[model samples]
Target chain A: MYYIDDFLALLFGISLLIAFWKVRTPLFFIASGACLTIIYSITLFFISETKPVQDIIFYSMACLGCISGLLFIRVMLIRSISLHALKLSNTMTKNKKECSIEDQLTEQMTSEIGFRLDDLQQKGFATLTTDGSGQLTLTPKGRVIAQLVSRLYRAIER
Target chain B: MDTLFIVALTTCILLAPIAAEIVLKGRRLQSNVKRVAPLYIVIALCCITIGAYTHYPHPIVIVMYWCGYFLTWFGIRSHLESSILLKMLTTLQTSNLSRDELMSSYLQSYSTQSRIAELKNSGLLESKKGIISITPSGEKLLSIIDLLD
Candidate 1:
């Protein structure tokens, strides 16, 4: 019995060590909880005096172990949720303004529908400079309205 | 000798998890060692209560168990934290940023230039033109961080 216990304990210990060294976050917590629970239980065997007290103590330790494990898992879940929310916010923020401008430009150039400004230049929708830049930089009226719409979109998104 | 071996083995088992937790928690947050010590106390209390009721060994044996437990905990925790720090350094080394940009963004350190230089000298990173990259060994170290993330 002792040998089996020792062997299992050693195996558990080595696995725990490997988990630490590898630093795999998910395995790290699981391995830690397992090793701690096993070690506590085995060590208790050598220390407890009365059978009733021993049983009670072991049961409580098990409960504590379960709670600790649950807490660690809870923290992990919260961390992942917060990270996801941040990523979503960042993506929305970066694209929100640009998308609104694209929409407004599309609306103003109704004749060039389904065509990019660059494409329109290629199809002679507007003249081009020798350098191939578009002649019509959105007029101040277009620019101002586009900017306002973009601002409104951002405000609504937020 | 058998008793001592059992005691030592038990300690290792107990401490491994605590060490792992410490490392994970430490890397994610700027927590103090003192703040995390309570978890170990709770584990120790559990171990003691069970040990006392089951067979009640000598007080000295019990002390040895706790000492061993704490020592293992500290050792593993320190090792894991250093490993994580090393991984972060390796990632910075391999990133496509210029020395100044790398320092400002990923490294978030004032002395990132010197730090990158140090890593290069240590053979953890190699630089070409203005681009820096992690070496194979550095990549292996960084693999740990990648796995964690």
Candidate 2:
């Protein structure tokens, strides 16, 4: 049990270090988990007489750590979804021409906007034309893009 | 106190992109999901590390964390969908065509049910006597679009 605990600790420590080194934003969660661990370890080390306190600290840290781990998984899942959306958009754009405004918009969207029309459509951000054709129409929600672009233009002008 | 401070600082950093997006471009918060996931993951990972070291054995913690994460994810997804619908409607409003013409054009081009659903959801258009017209809320949202000019 001692060896296993040590191994887990080492793994977490190494992960924390890498997170810091890579400037991984997710490191914040890991760091939080580490801090909880440190607190528990310190309580166990210094408060040997206070068994109840030790237990409480141990439980609290464990709870926090588990929660953090689950959150990390969720974040990963969201990232995967976003990546999948981008990939789908890229694949859709890749098969088409790029010189026209529509193609240019699609290309700019996949490359710069990091989203795809299908994803938007599915999400209610946009919709497909009803003619059983591949035509895409921006939904009202998509109107924000024009607003966002105009804002950028205004800022640049300023 | 220390933990709270760290958490607050971290949350602020994590939310920076959201603030920037809203202020800089008036984009919906959901649009930044790809960039924001890492921050949430980091926070989650940190909690896990803390839990393991604390030696607390409770499955409920993990469940709660995941539930919260998924809730936030879905919330963002819903918001993104709404934003897209809002954008399309605003574009149609600005075009040179009449409301009937725009509706017909959109109907001819896009799925009517989805378009109507989006409009209804966004509070942009109301249906009465089988006709739809822009609502006050819709006007407000569209006003933002005009402000872009």
Number of the top lDDT candidate = 2
* Model 2 segments more than 4 A misplaced: A1-158, B1-31, B49-55, B59-64, B67-71, B77-149
The runs of at least 3 residues in candidate 1 whose Cα sits more than 4 Å from the true structure, single-residue gaps closed, are A14-35, A38-40, A43-158, B1-110, B144-149
DockQ of each: 0.02, 0.03
> Quality of candidate 2's docking, in CAPRI categories?
incorrect
Per-prediction tally of clashes:
15, 31
lDDT of 2 by residue, B1-149 (tens): 13543354346445643444444353333433445455556655655555455553232333343334444444543333333333344444354333334434543443334444445554555555554445665556445433421
Best by TM-score: 1
> In DockQ, how does model 1 score against the reference complex?
0.02
List each model's interface RMSD: 21.0, 17.7
Instruction: Give lDDT for model 2.
Output: 0.44
Tens-digit per-residue lDDT, A60-91, candidate 1: 34333343434343333333222222233234
User: TM-score per candidate, in order?
Assistant: 0.28, 0.26
The digit string of per-residue lDDT tens for model 2 on A1-158 reads: 33433334344445443443343455565666567456645644454332355344543454454435444443533443322323332333345423222333333333322333235557774565576555455666656665664454343223
